[model samples]
Target: MADKRTTTPAGPSTSLQRGKACLRCRKRKMRCDGVKPACQQCTKAKKGDACEYDDGKGKTRTQLMREQIARLEARVKELEKSSSSSSHGSPPANLSLSASASPTPFPLDMDSSPWDSQWNGIPDFPAVNGITDSYATEDPPIELAQMLLEIFLPHRHQVGLEVHVGRLRDSLHLPLGEQRHPVLMNSIYLWACYLSRPGSLCEHEPLYLSRALAAVNDAVPNPSKVIDFIQASCLLSMYFLSNGRLLEGSYHASAAASLAIQWGLHQLGSTDLTVGVIPCDRESTFRLNPAKDAIEQGERVLAFWQVFNLDRCWSVALRRPATIPDSKHPWTSVITPWPQRMEDYETGELEINSGSPTIQAFFVHQAQVSPVVGGFSTFAHRVKASALFEGASRLSSSWYPRLSSSPSFTENFRAFEHTITRFTTTLLPLHQLAATLPDEKTSLLLIHSLAHASMIHLHQPFLEDQGSRETAVRAARSLAVVAKHISDTDYDYLDPFIGHCWVLGSEILASEIAQLQAAWSPHPASSELRVELNTLLFSLTKVAAKFPLFGYQATKVQKLLDAI
Candidate 1:
């Protein structure tokens, strides 16, 4: 009999219909169910939001790849236009940088040629450089520039950048030829070298450094944007400090503050402070058109705090008067509110003129106050710590009247002790630091370290007293813990002020070690003390090797120990 059964049609088509897969599935070379909104695999993976599909135009994989490439190229050109072009636009919401609040170790294999490294992302263009006269140098290619800039963005805070990063990134996308002013870019490139592992990138630092200084000088006479000067000066100052160039570093730091003061950044959002004497505008003061939006206003806010931090911390480091005045004079008084993050400005959370006094409140024995009710807690705490550092530095000087322990001095000293106690023991205590978010670790580390260092400085001049010695010892132990924490990590960038603290810290520990050695019998805690001392010295040596600013002090401590 003839077979009536019909053979089943081929089980399924051998080929996939083009454009049938979700984008993520296509990238992963997985089968797609073609579900709307999300595919079954993506939904199961909980990546529904990331799942996407092209229109069913039957485009090939190569065509989709080409489209993505074209889109990326457009973004680069757009950034190039922003970097050097005259037109200013409101920047996008976020940047490509990862963990900007505190940077983690970048995964790049620094020992390899940077050319071999993959393009991580675009620059967020934080204004962060140096000098007079143009130093001609071969410019890096676009690919290399992107890589180096990507390296700089996440660590912008480490370089003291105080600009609106999104806006700055918008400004940074211009092409190399259009970059008539490369001051900020070159400065970033130089630091990219400094921050990278010892490798080919490090070799180009001088070239970038020279060009950065030249760029600064070239721009000084006719800057397209004045804020770049202030931001560039900050990085230059930090760069010099790292290289152990004290005078140059101080000069740049003062210049940054002076420029900020002249720009009226110190008095942003207010002009009504009453003074006994009338004020007159100076020719050097550069005024800007009213900010078009909140981001520009926020940049102005950050510029002031950037200078304030440099002035306060460097003054303590140098044991000299800070250049940025904090007096009651109409022209010189700093009335700007404590800085809020760029987001606060973007979200309309800040009340500009409502902030009464920042440093003024600190002078009256109150913590510095920010306009935003609860702004970046880390920044506020750091600002308070900076004030404490400045006060402690002043009191440690032999000529400071506070050294005499007069009734007024005693009162002020006790007040400082109380504030420092609260800072280290209550608000943002060190023991709880490990629980902080990853992005906040470095800043919190700096805050606790600075607080304890302030305690050491406050008690150092009176170490002759048993009470003072005990207090200083206690603070030194805390500093050791912080240093040990730092040693455990691989952070390539740190503020110059931290190095200054390490110098003082190493000195105190060295002194204690010597005293113990001189005793006929070993102290019961001798082994533990040696371990702490070794840890501090090890960290100090590591830092000094990388940053020369602390080398002289580290050498002194090592020599002192050798003699003991």
Candidate 2:
């Protein structure tokens, strides 16, 4: 069969250049006026999210989204024809333009959203034949699906934040697609399988992953259901990253960001807060309606930050540019406030709703007063920390190789080091003030680890400087301290990215250990250094056993320890 395509919906006509357009235009078979970064057609159509040039390597982010959702829509269509499928169910809620006959454009104004019970009064309907339709082959029985969900819940933060876990748990009986959406349900299943490694249930990983992948775009056309895809994409991206699949991981990571943009999650509440957010859909073509409840609103906010955190940290992790640009770029402007904890939203304790430019403020050293640092929520800190790590990484030689001696590099270094100093010394209370649960403990460890690693990576090129080298030494020592605080249980709960994180400072530890071992009469503290090194290594060894994504990095870290 030939490829299916669509033209850009009609927009204001303007003078035509008649040259190459963006990959989005090319695929849509629209006329080309070839523009850079974003095309005029896309700009006018306000599809800045989908506008990107062809680098001639592979599919554009928009193409991937189209294909992913195309399959999902097909699946839904297939179910539509199934004699047994239900036809009475309602889509999540209405909000959007004529992007497709299926999804309407969102309005820019919040008060205008169709969120009242009058609009969404259609009662919830059970999915057709339960959740079985998501799978192409065998659908797991309800009993098995519940078990997998139980396995996933404990680790859902790593997949993507599940706002109102109780609600999710209670909704399991609602049928998979409506328990949220099949895309999200399947995404959780694959995570359960991945995290359940070495167990008999792990054998089902591929089945769930395939189903999850196929569900990618099912809700793209449904305004109310697109958040399901945004969230599932985030989970799927993390899954690939955990297994060390960088390209696909990066692909889906950006896909989540793209989906968020298309869904208007990025600029959520921008109009209400009067937060100078220039909408990606300038015409307010795809307005995100006010959420049905605070919990629902919290879900949208959480999804944006997860995508932001992934984009910021993983771009540095994968050594690529962030898909979510931080400049005042209208296309990618993120006006959403930093996220609050689930409890905060549930209890209406949303102090982080001021809505200034979050990433921008944090990077500009305005965090303390910028509403970002005000909320001491787990997610608030996590988001800011990733931005700091990304900021620090940008100054590292690893990100901009061959610029060590450049004047601009020297200037940027001071700012990066200053930010690290403020965070570690004044802002971030290093004490385990909030961590208790295994997951929380591991999360705090990851944040602390990233903070120290940021200093290490930034100071790497300045290793010849005594002060810079000692700063790195202190950071490495701090890494060991953080690692020791984590119990063995936290190892299973550790984020897969932390594996790469361990490799960062272990080499520094190895160097220090080697130096101490060579001394004929080492300092009394030398043995303690060895113990600290051993602690970090122990964590990595445990990690290697559990997470395949971390295995390669784990091996590298073990070799460093062995050589010493």
Candidate 3:
């Protein structure tokens, strides 16, 4: 080979050099032909737009991760400081003394409180119960807390626990010892844990719940903490109810109601200053000075409506007398202003002297004067409809059997029906057929479902009349249609209350089917009814797969269908 003419020396071997790759290539573990602006692999994969490179001055991925961990640890230490300080020594005796000094109209019996029994079966967390000082002083891991918060934010509005999101975020930035309300914080975490994805989180539900219970148990006896205590109790009530713990939920609900009354939330902005009047300057009868800022005032206003909405909704669900009745609690009838949007409070747009109309007057005056210009928010409208739904439920329960002889029942029913009809006609335009966004559509469907459900409930007791029977059947059909549409489409967002409407509507239809099948001769529309029932059941099963409570409901509906 040396003798061969100018044998070419072995050229440098063509080898791949381990050059720094673009971020996308590095993440994908691919070889990068390091090109400017875009890499070959990314371009070939049609992801050139996503291809990026780390500048020499920028930190590496590992370094960024470490920084995040450090921040989280700092937050945890802050949270721990408050707990550690409190646990190290007993709270001042003056705290209790000052609480007692305040004149509470209906004082809670601290000795034999109802909430004491409700906490029995909940397991104690070693960390929460102070088994070891170290555990008691530690805050929850940041990862777990973050996960829980993610689950809670989207669903809070559905349950009527819409606190100021901006304020909450800011609170997280403050030192742990400076956090505003421990009871509220614990309650928030408790519900977040309850709603977390199915796994170890489910096992920790009772632990968080116990922590909340302990906090509220302590806070209730202190007059200065009453407002925050009531807020926590209200959240706990819904949390229990959503988890199928009805008795505990009812107890907490009643407790919240009592505290709300004691704190004068029910009587806020009362026109008659003598009845349940808050201790404020007489000149400012229309506006209370209890709240120090717009955010606090907004929360107070929203809290009242939250409790009102729960009382009305659950009374119908449980078939029990409502704890806050309009006749006995004249404050319930007072025309307090509707709550402003959370953003308004955050931006300082809501003033103490803002002349917002009371919900009662809005319904009576604004609605009549400008039906199309409805001033109520979606939530406010939903609550208003809930009131009507509750009233219809109560009337049916009390007078269905005695309708033939009860003139008063007939008169009340007529008036209530008129009110509901007017309200339905006055719903916001966005809640009509014109809604375009997915969320708006879902909300519209919910409101309409509730309206129809209320109609079915109202007319079911009067089914002997052909007109009433037709109305019930029509409403039931409308509900089934909406439910089926929601399921068929990929509109996956539904509130807990929306599930309630589905179950109620299903019951009405199932009952009607059973009645028809029981008749001596089958009804002419039996075949059509069977088809509709099957369609509705299919929709329910599909939607149930998304929500745990709805899944339980679907199981019950399946059993009903099997029997039929």
Candidate 4:
């Protein structure tokens, strides 16, 4: 009693009170607590759910753990059984594979290593067999299909769309192979063809379409495999439908939906495959009538475009070096500069990643005109053009100044001039190609993009420059033609595109009139001309303000109106 005065009873062990014992230990699995969430005994013993207290109340924690362990063991057994049956039923036609084995790399590069590497977030095509149906060869399509499997799936590597197309074209010409792995083969064929179609500049060939379809038809032999395969098939078809191939694309996509239900795959890969299908009823020359598939495809594609635009712009911002002001100390930390060569140039080659083939052609042509700076500036303009269609409101006074040029205003003007010319010349033709296609939705999308591009060009600051009045006027006149296109289109089904363009058109008109008025000289009827222009600008401003995206544009115009 005399010695105990210095110390009180020790507190309960904090760890034991906090419920930190491993599940197996709690469940009386006859193993140490290990006190880990994932105990070695549970993991190594494959008793995943065997962790709880052994206190017996006929319904204690250990009893629940035992039940859970039984269930998990049952599930593991089922999966093992299914996998073993599938493997035994049909071995791979060309190359045998197991999930545990190291995969062979398929060689399928389109041009070179750079193309084979990641661009933006997309991985380069794998080194798979490059043979296509169009290639001068007579090998049975199975060989090419085998090549595709090796490139895309046998190794499960991410590949670009182009490589898939090359293998598909090869497979298409060859005779059909045995239905050993129909679902997988069907998937490959369908996706490759879908991705091969020219849509936008960013539109490179799709590498998996044909393989997916071929896998379904000849890759997986069991109709039961359809349940497993249908989701991927639908994905490839959706990719096609989204890229302006609605008619034929819808057929495969619909088939996928039916098969998904038939094979009971809806639960396993619901959104992974069928999340995009919607309900609608509209006949079109280009795309299918609005049904679950079309609706799903439309929404998904629109979402993709939105994110794609945001990413391109964000990438530009990330690439630009931090231009610290001179007000800071001269003894700044050393920072390495980005590589400047297009070959050496990262943003130096292409700033806006549209992923459209048509745009790439423009890049190639401009490269010849002025290989380094000129080409870079021209591409920079293309990126700016995207601003018109991209922002929440097309007409908003967003600064899409040339990215590759010097920060000086004079440099911006020069870049703007080159970009305008390139935009006018190429953009129109690209839209024209869309018009020729039967799909109204695709055509409208193309037209909208073209209109936005023109509008951005018209709104560049040169319109207010006295020395550039003539050039500004020319661009304005060209823009008027695009405006007429926007005005003429029936925007009933195209509220998104129309709203974007209408705001842009208003911005262009207002800016142009403001430039002309600013350049006005003291002439006899100057007051009357000014008043007339003001009225027109006011009307445009009212229209622009009504749109959500262009409300900012409208507000700016109203302020300008007040000042005038």
The TM-score leader among the candidates is 1
Error of 4 at 472 (Å): 4.0
* Better candidate by lDDT, 2 or 3: 2
Ranking by TM-score: 1, 2, 3, 4
Q: TM-scores of all models?
A: 0.70, 0.69, 0.67, 0.28
Q: How much does each candidate deviate from the true structure in C-alpha RMSD?
A: 13.9, 23.4, 14.2, 26.2
Considering every candidate listed, which one attains the maximal lDDT?
2
Give lDDT: candidate 4, residue 187: 52
- Model 4 RMSD in Å is 26.2
Candidate 3, 1-564: lDDT as tens digits: 766647776664443354356766665577887775778888887656455655444664334433544554454445445545776764322111222221211123324422233434533322322122232343455544664565566556655676776566566657775454667766887665444333223334545665676677667666656667777888877766654555667777877876676566765543332233344444433333356666776677678778877787776776667887554234444344455666566666542312233444543445456433233666667767776788778777777464667778787777767777777776644323322333335556677777777887888778778888877887777777776556333233455566677777777677777888888347777666667777667766665554444566777777787877
* Candidate 4 Cα lDDT to native: 0.34
Against the reference, the lDDT scores of all candidates come to 0.63, 0.64, 0.60, 0.34
Report how far residue 342 has shifted in candidate 3, in Å: 1.8
Candidate 3, run of 10 with poorest lDDT: 93-102
Which stretches in model 4 have alpha-carbon errors above 4 Å?
1-306, 310-416, 427-464, 467-470, 487-489, 495-547, 551-564
Give every collision pair in model 1: 79-173, 79-174, 80-173, 80-174, 82-171, 83-171, 83-172, 83-173, 83-174, 129-232
Ranking of all predicted structures according to lDDT, beginning with the best and ending with the worst: 2, 1, 3, 4
Model 2 off-target regions past 4 Å? 1-140, 175-177, 271-281, 351-355, 370-373, 398-411, 426-437, 512-528
lDDT of 2 by residue, 1-564 (tens): 223324545675664444334655655578867656677778886556446654444674334533543443344334434423343453211111122221101111223211111212322311222123333643445555666676677677755565677777676777544568777878887777566544434544555665776666566676667777788888877876666555566778887887777666676654343222245556766666566666777777888888888888888877778777666876666667778777677876544444466667766788787544354666677777788888787767554556757788778778878887777664335464322433455677788888888898887777767797788878888888887776544565677667666777787777766765777446576677678777777777787676555566566667777776
Q: Locate the minimum summed-lDDT window of 10 residues in model 1.
A: 96-105
What lDDT tens digits, residue by residue, belong to model 1 across residues 134-196? 225545456656766766665677766755555555544666444525777788877876765
